[model samples]
Target: MGEMYTTHEEEKLIDIVLDSILSGVVIIDNKDHVIVDVNETAAKMIGLAKEDIIGNVCHKYICPAEIGQCPVFHPWQNIDRSECVLLNYKGESIPILKTVKKIKKDDHLYLIESFIDISKIKETKEELLVKEKAIDSSINAIALADLEGNLTYVNHSFLELWGYGDEKEVLGKPSVEFWQDESKAEEVKNALFFEGSWVGELLARKKDDTDFLVNLSANMASNEFGKPVCMMASFVDITDIKKANLLIKRKLEIEETVASISSMFISPKNIDQTINVALEKICELCGCSRSYIFRFSNDGTRMSNTHEYCPEGVSPQKGNLQDLPVEMFPWWMGKLHNGEAIHIKDVSSLTEEASAEKEILEMQGIRSLIVLPLYTNSELTGYLGLDNVLNTGEWEEEDINILSLASQITGAGLERRNAEDMLMNAKIAAEDANLAKTEFIANMNHELRTPLNSIIGFSDVLSSENFGTLNDTQKKYLSNVVVNGQHLLRIINDLLDLSKIEAGKMELFPEKFVILDAINGIKATMMPLAKKKDIDLKCNINIGNPLIVADALKFKQILYNLVSNAIKFTDQGGSVTIGVNTSNELISVFVEDTGLGIAQNDQGKLFNPFSQVDSSNSREYDGTGLGLALVKNYVEMHGGKVWVESEVGKGSKFTFTIPVENQITRA
Candidate 1:
């Protein structure tokens, strides 16, 4: 135990060797736990010089052991090594892994203690535990397996996800056995080996042998030599997600079918084609073998497959069924008559109520069928039928509801077809009537104008005294006859012209002429009548472009009709003016009369043939009620428009505009 036994130089040599090592070392007597020898590493570790610690008790510096409780001094206690702290000069704690063991050297037993800093190791160990806990609590299934596919480790979620009660059930077993598809497992293994990872969806098997869809990702784990030794995998169950996607796809198909059928009914050019397309879409969407629309007869005693569709190599009922008698299927007829649709899943399982109908259906190779009643105006009109000859199918409520909508669309289409037919027939009848009226007017104009002109000619001849000298009374009477005949001829001509316009046979011979000249001619002829009525007649022409290209004769007739009507409506001393506002763009003519204005309600009737403004005024004014109608037609034929503005007792202004584009008409 005496340190002076060794030379100073030898002790220094031993100290250098001890301090050169990374771990602190010290020696003590096993009997008393006394420090007999210490190395430079130990001196630096405990903050002491060799001389001070050479004889001190070991427990005072590094060991917090009780009397004779040192692990090395009392090896029989079985405490070989333990963690402890050492006090430095600054009274700070130094962490050390202190181990003591009895060693016999030079026939004397001593305890050698060894330790090093381990703070980083403790921190890293805690962090690793935290990560393990995180992996175990994850929602995703996580597992590790050996290269040979033996399950090495699994998390709690992995156990719960694969229908396993405990990890012991799957550990060390082939992971491929957990896959529903073995080929997919091979694929995953190959991907992990070649690409360092594998990611995809695959069908996986549970412990109960039930299959589920899973989104799986697996990565390779390697040893220190960089050789792949195991695999780490994470999975999420997606079985329900796959089912929902299928449902969404089916819903889209049904919606597309409904849209196509609705479009067909809205614009049905060919009824057969529309019905066929509708049937094809419905059949395709519902996975039916055939489809048809059976319309009920008027008496409800029979029905017929008016429209039918079938796949290739299938028999068509349209060619064979003609007015199928309702008595043939008694039970079916009763249901249809009550407005109830019929759906049969299996003809072989029909009850007593469907025996007769099922017998007929099976005779035609029908296994399953569905019928939806079609209605129009709250009355059952027909039915939409679907047949599945190959497979006995059960129709879902959602599918039945879609077919019902198809039935309604069929009803609307048929109803619209009937309406269109009626409209066409009515249109044809009206055209025939209009043609007859036009011909009648043409013949009457010829027949009435001949004798009327002869009467006028004779009256004028007699009044002229060409045949003989006449008395004053005879002269006055002849003048009256001529004036009345002229009036009647004018009325006949207006009727003929209006008929021509309405019949679309009226023609205009356009010519360039000063409209004022035509107005002058009319005014000269009408002034005598206006003077007789004590009314003033004037023509105001603002002829900026007097070289107007129009039907000059018709234009004069239009102005004459308006002016004459005004003069007739005006009282004595009232004024009648025919004027125009001309421009490069258009020529507008106004016939304004200071006289009794037409009523607001009666103005609508003013331009209708044979429609007078007022019954009371009709008795006072001489008119056939065709003047304004002819005026409107004539003005319109020249690409012009006419409108009237007036107030009660404030007179009226009838204005008409002729676009300059119409001036393109040449003589």
Candidate 2:
């Protein structure tokens, strides 16, 4: 009985040890049967109660037909070792990594099977796969390099960044090949070792043989023992940033140059000097080697090189105005006529015909240029040309704008200089004319008064009948003598008045009077002369009684001269019409005549003092030819304009405008 108790105790001890094992365990008897003693974990794994499985056959219970069969059931019947799947009571198969062994004790066969659930292992594998896929899809370049500076792993982003086809092609290659400068590789290696990290810019080469800059961050990765394992690196491209910075620097330089050139205007003296200084500033700032300023003649076909500047020993001759080939510079000609700016970026890139002029420029080392047309009050005055002789590439848009602004400033300076020149010339001409008038007045006084004194003395004697009583024939002759003497005196007075007007010494005495009344008075005074020629004298006053501020006497004289001249030119049976029209701001008067009209060629000479339309016209008119001249001066003094529109045979119309009293009411 003690021996029996020892066996039970030993069996119980073995069961406790088996249940304590972390793996699931099951036992089977001979004939592939079960002496079921499953541990707690084994019972849970098969979904069976311990009592239910205790006496069941292993093949029927754990490896039922139509389910996965367990290899442990027939371990000795087969190879004596096996693994298999087990089925739960619900008939669901559970995959177990199983090992089966046979044991013999006292002629009873026994099977021991051990296994672990592989579902957890499969789950861990799937998690690792997902993490790898996430790393591959990232955009930033991620790479792992060994302590020896050899690449061990590269994600898709890293491969793409360096333009590598696959890991096989790039895994063992040195990371230094990506750096454009070979010396930077040693610097990077030292930084990684000493500081355990490095982050900065690098010039990297591309697959297409191009190079770019990248902002890169690299750090040394180490194991827990402080032993170096690998390195991790991330990079971002910064090529565009570098380029933008360079462009900004260039633009600032151009602005500084524009400011310097504009300062020349403060003391500009001559147009040529102003343009030369501006062009020199542009060439210096832009690194341009050649520049020229060309002045176009009044007829734009001609262009003369007014000023030119080049680097030492490279100057062009001052070209003749007509020698520049027109066909070679169609763009320049068009700009000269149309007042536009021309920008040529690359002369060599143009078509053959367009670039035909490039040979001369290229020989002088010019690659690009800009031509800007200069103007004076809408007239094509000249051109400003700036050329880049030493630059290898085309000029950028910013360069063109800078030079164009300088050209505009130069154009404005030229215009101001031209205006000053014209004003100076006008001043000198006025002084010369004043001196001549003073000498002419002195000569006229001495040459004409002696004859005038005798004529006037005789006329007074004859008119008073102071000499003697005379017969009818003698009296007629004496009347003729008095009439001739009075006409001579009138001629001398007219000459004196004209001289005063020419010297700008005439004074205007202005008064408000109805303009139509003045027109009518002049017509009445000239009617007798018109009647003597048997001509119709008429006054058409379209203007109502609008008052005008003018010298009434001078205004009357202006009208009388025009009307009398009309009557004198009219043949017998012809008509003289004097018309006046007034509006809100202006009064217009027209004197029309049917007469031997003045010739077109002689119209311009009619207003000059002491000048007539023709010698025959003077002979026929029998007076000093200063009437119209004085009439012009009188009209202009009242701020009016006078002009004549006449054809050789179609008669003449003299028109004049006077500002009315209401128009100048404020003044």
Local accuracy of candidate 2 as per-residue lDDT tens digits, 210-302: 888998899988899988888888888788888899888887888777777777775676657777777777777766767777777666655
Top TM-score model? 1
Worst 10 residues of 1 by lDDT: 658-667
Candidate No. with top lDDT: 1
**What does candidate 1 score on TM?**
0.82
Off by over 4 Å in 1: 1-127, 327-330, 351-355, 472-477, 538-547, 599-611, 615-625, 661-667
What digit string (tens of lDDT, one per residue) describes model 1 on residues 540-573?
Answer: 8877777788888888899889998899889989
Give the least accurate 10-residue stretch of model 2, judged by summed lDDT: 73-82
